[model samples]
Target: MNKLLIFDLDDTIFETKSIKKESVKPIFDQLEPLLINKFGTALTAQIIPELWKYPFDFVAEKYKFDKHQNTEFARFINEHEYKLNIRTFDDFSVVENLKQEKILVTTGFSKLQHAKIHYLGIKQKFSEVYIDNILSSERVFKKGIFQSILLERKIEPQLVYIIGDNPNSELKAGFELGLHTVQVAKFGQEKSDYANYCISNFNELIPILK
Candidate 1:
């Protein structure tokens, strides 16, 4: 059977933490007043760190951000691009050398996600790249995209593998679809109950894939 590997972009392939907080602070600076006005200082302060860590939709929902706040936040984040070169994890070359058909499915604001992909220069590495644009009018989260790929490609669940860092996102989605789930715990994250395998390095995938 032909095997397919689906990947997540941010913490899975590369470390978003490599993006210095101060590097992105200017964009947030422009957004703070708007957020503060809606959610007040303390809540807005709490939301800022999460904005850095998660996609805007998740953050917006978690913080109860209104429609106007969501629009303003997307306006600032989607328009800004990282001007610095983004780097992937050192062990990412193991993924680069893997022969399996690979697909990248990441969730974020469109322009920022595309900017990271451009800066990493690993676009050609994947068979196709998908961004779950939070700013879109109709957002299909990772699960919908994964399911569509399975249906469109006529792929069996057993032949597919989903690899990502977020337990609630790709890992859970893959699990629900009966695809193999591999959690990439690059930062020493604890194993999730949903993962079939927990691996810190891409090299560890060799044994699992076998």
Candidate 2:
């Protein structure tokens, strides 16, 4: 029997941090003044390091960004596009070539996330690609998307695996819905207690999926 595989795009399929400094510098330069204005120099300094580490919405919420601040940030983010092509991890082909049905569910500004997908050239690999746009007023999360997949496909929770790197996001959501959760520790990331299995690359998943 084939199983359903749900994937998280960032950090799972590819390293968002690996985008060269030159490619991302302009974005930071534009954001620096905005952050400094809202949070001042000291707080803005602390926030810069975290922008690449977490989703923009996560960072914004952690720093107590107001409605107007969020709007401005979203405006700039939506306007920006990646200049160079992005590459997936070397072992990503293992997942890509698998016969089982696959889906991509990720969170970010729609345009930025779509741009990454476009550059990576993997949009056609998934049967479905859903983006949880943080800037949207009615943004839906991974949990809701996972639930919809299960319901629409009429698959048992045990027959699906949620693959991602974040414990607070996909892993937690998959666990709550009784699906198997696999954490892809691509950067030597510590294993999350919520993950049913942790893997450094897709090759390790063959036995688990079997």
Candidate 3:
């Protein structure tokens, strides 16, 4: 069987969880004053943590903030993170050595995600990359992407594996599509209910995916 492996970009291939934490200060410095003015200091502190984890679209929806108004803030975050070079956690030699085919599916705007991929020098790592601007919902977007890829490539659902950190978005979609689902987790964390397999780091994928 021709194997087709799908990986998520953010926390899966790149160290998005740690990068998000490291980015908080620089991101805060750029956006906090505006937040203070609009939301007051108390509420600003309360919301920043949640906002830090996910995309700005979620932030826009939750706070009723205009998505257009957040362009500058989002740019600052992307640019700032670019400089960090928060590359793949594992050396990526494992991926390079892998025999199975692979692709990237992630939910985020194209510009920033592409920038990160370019700077990280991993553009060649995947056969295809999908950085979708999610409509309807993130989960729906992922499932649709998975289905489309399956149809477009004429791939068998059972021969596919979707790997990601976000259980709800990537892993769940893969499992629902009858593909193998792997959840990459932070060290010592519990595996998600949606995952058939889990690993504490990206390196662990080599053996299983091999």
The residue ranges of model 1 lying beyond 4 angstroms of the native Cα positions read: none
By TM-score, the candidates rank as 1, 2, 3
Clashes of each: 0, 0, 0
Task: Report the C-alpha displacement of residue 144, candidate 1, in angstroms.
Answer: 0.4
Which runs in model 3 stand beyond 4 Å of their true positions?
Answer: 17-30, 67-82, 134-140, 201-203
lDDT of 3: 0.76
In candidate 3 the C-alpha lDDT for residue 136 amounts to: 28
Tens digit per residue, CA lDDT, model 2, 63-84: 8888987887777777776785
**The candidate that achieves the highest lDDT relative to the unseen native structure:** 1
The better candidate by TM-score, 2 or 3, is: 2
Q: Give the clash total for candidate 2.
A: 0
* Residue pairs with backbone overlap in model 1: none
What are the TM-scores, per candidate, against the unseen true structure?
0.95, 0.94, 0.79
Query: Which of 1 and 3 is ahead in lDDT?
Result: 1
In candidate 1, what are the lDDT values of residues 8-117, reduced to their tens digit?
99899898878878667878998889888887899888988888877777888887888888787777776776685578889989998988999999998888888889
